[model samples]
Target: MSAEATPLSIHLADDAATALFGEDLLLALQIGDCVALYGDLGAGKSTLSRALIRALAGDPDLEVPSPTFTLVQSYDLKIPIAHFDLYRLSDESELDELGLEEALAEGICLIEWPSKAGRALPKNRIEIHLAFAPDGGRTLTIQAPEGRLSRLRRVIEIRRFLDGHGHKEAHRQHLTGDASNRAYEHVYPVDGSARLVLMDAPKRPNGPPIRDGKPYSQLVHLAEDVRPFVAIGQALRERGFAAPNVLAQDLDAGLLLLEDLGEDGVLDSEGRPIAERYRASAACLAAIHDKPFDREIVLPGGHRHRIPDFDRAAMKFEGELLLDWHLPWKRDGQLATVEERTRYLAIWDKLIDEISDADTSIVMRDFHSPNIIWREDRDGYDRVGLIDFQDAMIGPAAYDLVSLVQDARVTIERPLMDQLMADYLSLRAMGPDFDESRFLKSWAIMSAQRACKLNGLWVRLKDRDGKPGYMRHLPRTLWHLTVAFEHPVLAPLRNWCIEAGIELPESPA
Candidate 1:
């Protein structure tokens, strides 16, 4: 083991505590992880393994038979697990025949009596030594590779946070996370009552300065901590929107127990956009834009969250994503020339200048299908429950509308998108000083801006972040840009794209 392999000790008072520890381990575990359990005959290795397997299966009643006789037993769950009891193995080389390598390649592995394997185990396996305590309980000494120690420590912190609150016995189930660093979990009470959401967002550390001594996140005004969510959600709720209520919070720790806004999003059962829900969402945005909003929002404990402006710097920075990531990716590792970058940025500068006096509101930076919840029980604008607005900024009202009508994740047909746009425009036109022509121009500029940002963002997420799935949206974003360039304001960008060999489809699909 490396010199940095430090052991963490934990005492489990009873079976329930041991089970909870298993759940914590599940949270920390990833695919290809090997957990080696070391204990004597009557220690809690089997108990811990069973608890972890059951938790991964999301079934408390799952039958996890011991693999002692079989040597290896596999379970096909969310993250496939292979439970191995190598005590019966006669030779270490038999591990290959038992598919130990395959198990570790495809999913997680739990090994009991791992000593039988000799040096066949992976070097970075997590080791858990369990022993009987003097008080008839169990004690565990756990050590993991240095690269994985941070995740294990985070799991321990989450458990402590839950215990400090009134949810020591809550059953935790992992929820799908977004592209950001934040993660979430469903916390169910011991009594099987309503569930809550645990937002586990750690404060983001500053990266190497990209420009003017600021990182990309700071330039684009991304939320660094959970305070923005707390403040923005409170502001939205006070304005009659259905943002999730904060049940409990730890600002310093970036943890929040939020009311579980149910999983009915704007998409239907088949993952297609529901027209009525889309219209409702547009109306909700209109209602939000029409209201007067304060720049500084008072959070709990009298602290304030000052909403940042979507300034020219932010807009230019985002537009450059296309130049930085997408263009190079399209050209097979060849970067854009200095002159091409200068021209692309110049076009963006003009577009941003054109939208200088456009309608301003508290723009939810990601007001799209994924962030929108369809609350059927609620009426009017309240029917649309908002989440994931921590990165909200004060910017062009048309930007949110663009996010909805031209959703990044889903393809919204031109007809339905037009109707949704009309739904929002008609409502906003009733307000004082609403200029249809100017708003449409701003809408076109913002649409093209968003398209440029997303085109580069998808490539960055794929190449730099190891997330290739986001690349699937590249075609749709290109289509959106093509549509945006139909407006006269984006003609310069359209010509530049054509000159740069970026294809723009002539017709919508």
Candidate 2:
């Protein structure tokens, strides 16, 4: 194994601080990792393990009893976790009977009294040595063998980064995430001051070239790092929209300390979309659509990122995920033939070309309910706070409008969708040269394209990423597919679905 940087040592003032440390470290774990907890009796090892397990389970009140007698306790989480206490084991060979190797292979294992297993402890693991602090507290000194440095080092880097930003003593709580590589933490300063949201989206490694020696992200103008977010949020703030203000940044590491937009969103307590909030959000979109989108946004370090246009190739490739992953999964492991794939692309090709004919503007690719924070304290469309715009691109203005009305996460009733459409057009018509008919045509085409893309995206998330919960959204997506069929432009794609025995919910049912 290659050498890594120095060991990261952390001092926790109390059990609360230990719990918080556990929460931060838990995010960095993966399957097959064995976190060996080494400490004397009552050094807060069990306390730390409980906090980590509860954080991973997303339930603070979860009961996690000591496993000294039970030996092992496993929980089925997004990443399965096995909590093991080896204090009662007589010999290292007992691990074979306890199935330690098999457990480690299947999921993350938290091993207590690892010395009981002695040399049997996994070589590739993180070892945390805890002890009593001089001042009535606990201390933790973390040591990761070089083979395990990649996991723990990132965790240490986050703490160092936060320390440099005047938030060294901030308490971090995990925020629920969506289908993105980014992880968010609600950073609350110990002084009860204003909170900040920490976005940790590291620069992704480039994949094999898919087109013109570019990966899919580059081909489609998807933001590969947080630089686009800083640049785009600045442009929006300058234009009077409410995007989170960047407080501190480490762009090289893809980390940002942003102003917390608060927990209140466009959705109500029952998770239903509020019409007034939706209207405000739609107005926000109309306001930005007329801005200068083709211009380059200045980023840090004298970097300029020109927003790429949503070209034909990018649009078609998105729909290909349907043919590539969704179709084959639906076919019970049978892959689509070359002829079927060709026909699918031909249908989408027409839609892509026709939609690209319309006027282009910045399309906040995901302007749906989940990304919009409703700040009632603010006035007008400023009340609508926009988040998650890293995937923004110069696409048809109608694309974001469609994203808002035909939201994938929440259902917007037919009447409310119609009202939002009218509100947007009326707002835009007051501005320069607005074509209602052309905009409507573009909306239909883009909405249809988005629906087709989502139909497969949900399945791909389930099969490729091991997120089967997305399958629950598949039915709503199919209903959306049928609604798009109302637009005659999508008839060819609809007819193909019929031939493929793909079920579509009866329109307006």
lDDT of 2 at 57: 88
Q: Please give, for residues 373-426, the per-residue lDDT of candidate 1 as tens digits.
A: 888998998889899999999999999999999999999998999999889999
- Model 2 lDDT per residue over 1-509, tens place: 12444677778999888887787778677778889999999898888899899988878899998899989898988778899999999999988888889888888899999889988877767889999999989878877766576657777788889889888767676676677778888887978999889998999777789989998778777788998899889889988889999999999899999998888988889978899889988888988997775459887679887777777887888878778777888899788888888888899888777775686788889999889998989898689899999888888998899889988888888889889999999999998878888788788878777877888898888888888887776776677777777777878988988887678886323
RMSD for all candidates, in order, please.
Answer: 1.3, 4.0
The local distance difference test score of each candidate is 0.91, 0.84
Residue pairs in steric clash, candidate 2? none
Give TM per candidate.
Answer: 0.97, 0.86
Worst window of 10 by summed lDDT in candidate 1:
1-10
